[model samples]
Target: MQRDQGVPQPRLLHIEADYSPAVSKTEPWVDLRSIRIDEYLQARSLAVKTQKAYRQDLQHFLRWTDKAWSAVTARQIAQFKTHLVRKEEGQRVLSDATVKRILGTMKAFYGWLWRCGYVDRDPTIEVQLPKLAEPEADNLSDEQVEKILAAVAGTKLCDRNLALFAVLQHGIRAEAATLLNVGDFDGQRLWVRQDKGGSKGVVPLDEEGVQKIQAYLGWRMSQGEVLLPESPLFVSASRRNRGARIGYDTIDKLVCQLRDITGIDFHAHQFRHTYATNLVLDGMNPYHVMTLTRHKSVQSFRRYTKAADQQAAEAAFYETKRRKRKTEPGSEQ
Candidate 1:
């Protein structure tokens, strides 16, 4: 009786395999404590949310199959995907996109196992990922962006807000913003060390961006606060967490605060989308823009190009028909 190893199992749910689970209760032969999940997560340098999602998705699969990671087969992985897609009452199910994500995670899991010598073969190779619709790129307009900026101007954290948003509008993510340090900025390049989905890189800053940051730092120093190279770029000014590094929740609250003040509802991530969309609108090659956006995958990058394409086509058609007339939505009737 060989002990199942590789990914550590939590507890026995129901063995979906033809054979029964190993009779050994202690499972002394099994390397349960040595589960490579933490190691794999750290190696990937995944974002906190992504790490959580990967853990959850993997756990769900393990709970369903109730088999050792070594025993999972390509066929069984496919079966699990099928189980996710076919919605049944009182049963675990997922959307097509979600099913695709789960299978992709599984593929990564098994690929790691094979590379690390834990498995002779990758079980996820033959398991097909479910097709999902191309994700639509969402963005705010120039005017809406300006409105948000204005809304943040009157706030007590105006200097910080201006500098933070200046960076965000250039393609940095919210999570990456929190990870930024004073040393990461050198007046020209903003080095984002911790990007979402692990896409870390240096983002170039324009003259205005440099000024915004300089003003923020100047303001920090003006208030008798010492700015160090190791200091967090953004710190909370609230009574409870003053002088402390801001968290992801703080970013979310900032978005809500801006939306409420400006009466323009929007998401924090839209800053990156807006940056990408505007570049595509300016006739940048989709492939080239990824270098600026630091996108790791072309599939996700397609949304920017597609959205820009649609908008350009519509504008061109309307301009031709109206002879420089702007068409409003639902005015065709």
Candidate 2:
């Protein structure tokens, strides 16, 4: 028998043959100690959460390779992708989406390395990511959305929750919502700050949303919190932290509370889905919907369109059945 090199032996969780290129782990590898990964991360100006995630992802690769960024080859990157997708010790590991994210980060890191002259060549150039399944578009019905709004409307801290729901309904990100200041709203339009492309844009609020926001502002004044242009639109009500900008955790907790009260397992993103679906259902062009949602790509907004199409198809089918039943001689009620 030919003495086996350190070829990855077949395991219980068979990796697809396509990604399993013939490679040896014992091949010459360099440690990543010298790579200026921190400098790279900071240079990108990533959001705090995103920076943390990228660090974690890069750490996973470093630990796996035990090699310097310069010593890493495309083969190893491909192998790493395989390792991430396969089951580790009888347990399924990362999902395809996670694997894709990891690879994307690595590609960016290595590309940066090459640009900065840290490496002669980028190793992650040709690594193919697993196809990501189209995200399922889950949106609550208009009635369900109204019920959620009503559940928090006019209740204690109603101002806060009302603003939260309205912002979510308008499809603003939770982080963006948390950063909103009193001056961002002008009775009719809400200026969404720190949007994805690092620019501010205005979204028109309906009269009802504006009225509720004004009511909430009035309530804040009643409690002696002065409403200044620079004041945070949403603030903590506790005496200790009064007038302090509300953090994302507080917004998330509020969403969870409403979810518990309504028995609806929905989050802020679902509100965005609901907004998009409602627009599609109301015969608004998806292009226009994407414009309102500030989606950079049509592909991002197409999920809502697909969901709306399915709902419309089901409604038409049921309506046809109902009409057929009514036409039958003995089916009339």
Best by lDDT: 1
Q: How well does candidate 2 match the true structure, expressed as C-alpha RMSD?
A: 18.8
User: Candidate 2 residues 13-114, lDDT tens each?
Assistant: 766668667886796664445347788977886667777888888887877867777888889998999889899788879888888888998999888889
lDDT tens readout by residue for model 1, 1-333: 776887686896885666756676663464452377667787786778899999887876867766777887878887887777786786646777888888888889889988988789888898778777888888998899988998888887899999999988998988889989999999898988788776778889989899999999999899999988899999999899999999889889888888778988899899999999888888888887898899988888988998778888998987798853446565654
Given candidate 2, what's the lDDT at residue 233? 86
Candidate 2 ranges with C-alpha deviation above 4 Å: 1-35, 197-199, 309-333
Error of 2 at 320 (Å): 14
Give candidate 1's error at residue 204 in angstroms. Answer: 2.3
| C-alpha lDDT of candidate 2 relative to the true structure | 0.82
TM-score, candidate 1, is 0.79
Each prediction's RMSD over C-alphas, in Å, is 15.0, 18.8
